[model samples]
Target: MSVLIENMTIKRGMKKIIDNLDLSIMDGEVVALVAPNGTGKTTLLNGIAQLLPSTYKKLEINGFEPQLLNFKRSFFYLESSSNLFEYLNIKEHLLLIKKNWQSEIVLDEVFRLLKIYEYQTLPIRKMSLGMKQHALLATYLISDAPVLLFDEPLNGLDPGSIEITNGIIQNLADKNKSILFSSHDIANIQAICNRVVFLKDGKIERDTKNMDEILELYKQLYGG
Candidate 1:
């Protein structure tokens, strides 16, 4: 039971973004997608989430082929950019997710966990970048999706927030959820990911569960 993509090929205009890529995220696992910029990390994530078009031999979630509504209900995708509504307050955003996704997670607990309870009444437009990031994190935490996809979730966060976010990721995996996130921070990847998949030249350059080996491999691939 995992989120699986096999023999996938993605293209953007004339340029190939992902060529014959195969990837999987099993239950109770956290996998880090590591690569230099323009290596198609986000493109691959979008393709799996079905947010973009791509051709694939097989794409499945928990052993079932992606059925639009079920797939949408089963996973959460956290974009690097904040997507909160300008007019909506923090609590309102949570309420919207609850209403739409039928999330069983409590809003107050999520706010407390993400340390954003005080800003619940403030409009997203008035919040700072860190606050907005917190809001995004809160939404993901409360979504209760089985699979989570995050792109640069630590961007713009302070050190404390980064620590909290890492803990949150671990907690989700402990609950048997699948997590696949892309991050440039090697330390964070080392701390949270059980496996690392390095992408290059529109394909997976390396995949390994050994943290030390992956670090060495990453340095060699990116010329550290």
Candidate 2:
């Protein structure tokens, strides 16, 4: 497994958001965490990325403990668009990550694929939500991390952009990277994710590789 979490617990003020949850994702697996809003999908990912205050009996990534440098290097996660520098352009941010991760992924290819060249030099302050989203995906591509976490990856994307993004994610899986993401788009999951895990009541209520009945399962479990 590339990520392992056991007996993990997280709380927000007085309420428990994640309660003794256990999750493990194997290499090359694409897992979708689905649930209604406020179900702690973001919290669980943040906890795994070590960005939140969490208590777990065991937590590790690719055999590296959460406190280790290797653990941090093993995953790429930038949840909020605010994490981007306001004054810098998308290319600048990509360059920074490329240098930091020492990634070999070609930036030219990324720019071309995401159609970022149109506004590659535009400052984050001036970019639209859709542009920022493209930049975010570009960063993940250049990070070259073994574990990648995404939240609502298809949100706000145009049809072409969604197609490209899905293709990229699928390519990454073909290369054996572990991907965990949260999304409300069921069709998107059926397109890329090999596994789906439903998060409810601060824990995974269902986990399965089968997607044939995803629609029925979703309505049955989530009352959609």
Candidate 3:
């Protein structure tokens, strides 16, 4: 149930984004990838999710090779945009995902968790950014997958929605779900994540194992 990356490297043309990266995420851990813009945070996530081809020497996820697990049913990735069905109503969009996944994932459960049930009838095109984020996140919660990859998790969320999102993430970690998420909000990282991994210049510059010390490190690194 853990993700292991050994000497992994990703290159795009002449630039090396993730170079000889080695890390391990234990089961049920809430991990955060932290960095400034263009630090390959998304690229590393893409590599872990197998969305992008990598030039690594070794990559293993849950004891299976990255390529094999990409084709398997155990991993799930939720982009920051949440890519909802723009033309479909919120409820219909959820229903469509449920139908395609054969009801293995539940919409109502997530609706209740996200408290988005009240706006279920609205069309996605008319929904606000926070609502769309909720809808996109709700789908992944319902999937009940082993590993969840999230990029720019709080991109469009307001303060209130952000609080709710934090609660959900904490709840997931409490439930022993393995979660990997990236965010620009260092405060959120301090509140919701157990550890913080900083990405810089295409490499993991720091991986803070102590949550209590993360704030100090963050302030020191980012110069708040």
Candidate 4:
């Protein structure tokens, strides 16, 4: 699956959140959207995913409009705090995810990989932030969606968790999944993404290879 955006813009009354942005991701690539807060990274993703209205734009996933794609079956969006059912135990969550995604064979494997097997019977509401994030990622893995979008996936994770997340994303990319994710973790971005799209004030500030060098140049450009 692939995604393409051309002249995409979003507005709220007088405010322009996304300004004439054009981006494209080929099949099976991991691309990172990097920016400071309030830069419309999430809004851009929302538009691409058809979670928000675009004023004037052309957005397509696999040659079809995002709104027309069978999102429930082919796409997964993982946000920072949307990990659980809030009322269900871990086992119930895993079981529901397995049933929803038809991934019974890998449910236990994902759980063990995430090291959440011991907490499988506990309520998700009682888990820590990192724990919940792990559970959420595990659910995504179980879903086996061809397109995965992540927002701030590295937040609140320890060093080991960060490494694990990076590895999981790399594995997904190797499996030919088209991935678009937003993050401020430059190290992780450099590790996983082949190219970078730098956003500022709702527009693309830079799109370049040599991500590490670009980050340093941008820092110098901003006198940081």
TM-score of each: 0.95, 0.96, 0.87, 0.88
Model 4 TM: 0.88
Provide the clashing-pair count of each candidate structure. 0, 0, 0, 0
Q: Mind giving the per-residue lDDT tens digits that candidate 2 earns over 1-224?
A: 89899999999998989998999999999999998888899999899998999999999887799778778878999986768898999889989998887799898988988888889999999988888889889899989999999988777788988999999999999999999999988888998999999887888888889987777788988795
Query: Which of the two, 3 or 4, has more TM-score?
Result: 4
Candidate 4, position 56, lDDT: 51
Residue pairs of candidate 1 with colliding backbone atoms = none
lDDT per residue for candidate 1 within 1-224, as digits (tens), equals: 67888888899998889999988888989999999888899999999888888999999976667765577778888565456787898798888887776899998899889888788999989988998888888888878888889988998899999999999999999999899888888778888899999999888889998887876888899887
Compare the candidates by lDDT and give the number of the best one: 2
Q: Enumerate residue pairs that collide in model 2.
A: none
Clashes of 3: 0
Ranking by TM-score: 2, 1, 4, 3
The C-alpha stretches of model 4 lying farther than 4 A from their native spots are 98-105, 220-223
Superposed Cα RMSD, model 2:
1.1
**Model 3, 1-224: lDDT tens per residue?**
56777777889987888888887888889899887777788889888877787877666665677557233345567565446777777678667656554446567777888898789888788888888888778776766666778988887889988898888888877877788888877678878888788776667778987877776776677677
Q: Quantify all predictions' global Cα lDDT against the true fold.
A: 0.86, 0.89, 0.76, 0.76
The 10-residue segment of model 1 with minimum total lDDT is 62-71
RMSD of 1: 1.3
RMSD of candidates 1 onward, in order: 1.3, 1.1, 2.4, 2.2
Error of 4 at 15 (Å): 0.4
lDDT of 3 at 146: 65
